[model samples]
Target: MKKVVKFGGSSLANAEQFKKVGNIIRSEEDRRYVIPSAPGRRFSSDTKVTDMLYDCYHQAESGKDFSGTLSNIRERYDEIIRGLDLDLNLDDEFRTIAENFKNKAGIDYAASRGEYLNGRVMAAYLGYEFVDAAEVVAFDENGNFDDRRTDKIMGAKLDSIERAVIPGFYGAKPDGSIKTFSRGGSDITGSLVAKAVHADLYENWTDVSGFLMADPRIINDPVTISTITYREMRELSYMGATVLHEDAVFPLRKEGIPINVRNTNKPEDPGTMVVESTCNKPKFTITGIGGKKGFASITIEKAMMNAEVGFGRKVLEVFEDSGMTFEHTPSGIDTFSVFVNQHEFEPHEQQIIAGLHRNVHPDMIELESDLALIAVVGRGMRRTRGTAGRIFSALAHAHVNVKMIDQGSSELNIIIGVENRDFETAIKAIYDIFVVSQL
Candidate 1:
């Protein structure tokens, strides 16, 4: 059984952390394909290598003297090399990087160096061949990832090597210009590798032991989720839960390969397992609770709104014309409401309101701001009855008012809208009912 392991920035911050990662890899023979991110913070106050590179590049772009910044970044890697007591020297690599920065080779090139240099170090430490991501991961001229070309090339490339280390985050455009994925993109690289190699499992090692049932900032010592399905994960992630990049699930889910989120510091803990489907039952009535703030709701009331043909489409067209995306729209026979990002809506609010008046011609249009949407998602919810009632009961007991609630047809998740002030309280209430009480 082959497994692809991806280590996060924190896991390789310094030589000591690097040693830990090396041991983790050596412990398992199946963990052959390795992916590494740039060195992260060694301490809370310390700067990450990637951030330093970005600063250095910014200074260079501004035509300012940036040698000091470049020297500092080099020192960080030198310290790691010294600690490891390796014979490897990065003088040539650093010289090339400095030259590229001086030539204004683009921020993508500067940002990618973190991973590139780290990959070299990791390969040297592990005795594995180093594979440059730019040569394998394909991107189009528009800077969009070309997954078809990437998979074909990556698959052939990996099949030739028994063990290798690939840097994550950034790939190359067709013209060889560098392009990076959004922040936290290493997760995407790992997933893509797992798919290309057809690995049985993708192990993502980070600081956390696993995904928690609720955000820890709100609920003290929240329970960790042992197993979560792709659909449930998507719902929780969309609502703000973030152990892995949401996009990472796409490639692995397509191949039916599971991902295990493990803690690098505490290797013994069996972290969260994400899968395509499972017959195993969840520990609680809900899998996870996550929510975000800064939403505005627009309520449109018209007589016999449900009976009016194309009424919903007309109302939505106004938002589309305004270039605003609606998050959720729950309606009744006479009234319907559109929920959207408050900041995005504010700029186009008057235009959207005017369009709604012209297109739908509703009797009344009311706007409410400062709303938060909470998702109570679980696969077990489909089998359990009164899930919505339990959520309402919990909120009512906590004295938190619910502004709106929407449940999809699949019965996989329930969305609750509340005032921003009550977001934390509502989440705690739901956690107590579904998790704390059970424990």
Candidate 2:
């Protein structure tokens, strides 16, 4: 039962957090492979090591002295080492990094040092082999991640090692230059490693115990999602739920490796399980609620619009020509509405209106701005009746008006459009009806 366990930055923030992570790992023999992110904030006011590294790198590039910043980074590692009672010294590592910084080794290389150094400390503390991500994770010369290449090499390398720690978030390009993934990329790294090893499960440890039914900022102490399928997760993630990096699921999707979004601090709590498909019914009719704000809808009306050939294409082409991608398009026999980012559409509104008049020649054009889209996603929703009615009932009771409603044929999710002012209230209402009321 091979398992790849990846710890987030907060899980290894300081000595205490590191000790907790160490105990979690040592408690499970199946956790044979490990991944570590950079040191995060120890407290709310504390700056992350990665941010400090970026600042130091910028200073060096601008021809300013960076000794103090580099020293502070070195101290963070020293503090962890001291707290862990390890005999390891990172003086040489610091010196090499300083020299590279002086040479302007690029921001990617500098930012990657946090994870690199933390992996070093974690390996020494756990007595496991340290595998540098640059040696395993692969990227192309263009700095794009090379998944197939990563899989081929990582699979061959990890096959022989019984236990090892690989730093997350960064890798090397074909020319051997450092390239880091975007922020929150450690999740992607963990996903890739799990796929390469074909592990039974990929455990992602973060500060949260599991995925919440709604954003906590909107709903107070939202119910935790016990189980969610890949499709439902993608739908919620696309709408703005951020418990996990949205792209992290791709690598494991084909390999059928389920990911466990666990909490480092609350190890006993059974966190959310994300699977490809599940027969296990969810506790609530809706598995999750997620949404986004700042949208504008362009509504066009013409008699017998559905009977017109190439009408939909013509409408979308106008948006495509303006370089504005529409988020959703709800239509009827005589009318159509295209949703796009308000900021993107505001400038091109006049031009798009003119173009639409010239192309489709609709009777009237109407525009509404400051819209928000909320997605109530769940696989069990397919079997449940009146899901949309309940959502409407809940929102109506909260005095939140729904401007638009769209649902895919799969019946897995319902997309509701509301005013920006009602975004939070809409989410709370949906959560209350589906989860809170059930409890």
Q: Estimated TM-score per prediction?
A: 0.99, 0.97
Where model 2 places Cα greater than 4 Å from the true spot, the runs are none
lDDT of 2 by residue, 19-45 (tens): 999999999999988899999999999
Q: After superposition, how far is residue 61 of candidate 2 from its true place, in Å?
A: 1.3
- Can you write out model 1's per-residue Cα lDDT over 1-439, one digit (the tens) per residue? 8999999999999999999999999999999999999999999999989999999999999999999999999888888888888888999998999898889999999999999999999999899999999999999999989999999999999998999999999899999989999888989999999999999999999999989999999999889999999999999999998889999999999999999999999999999999999998998989999999999999999998888899999999999998889999998889999999999999999999999999989999999999999999999999899999999999999999999999999999999999999999999999999988899
Q: Candidate 1, after superposition: displacement of residue 31 in Å?
A: 0.4
Question: Roughly what TM-score does model 1 have, to 2 decimal places?
Answer: 0.99
Candidate 2 local Cα displacement, residue 396, angstroms: 1.6
Q: Where does candidate 1 have its weakest 10-residue lDDT segment?
A: 78-87
Residue ranges of candidate 1 with Cα displaced over 4 Å: none
How does candidate 2 score on lDDT? Answer: 0.93
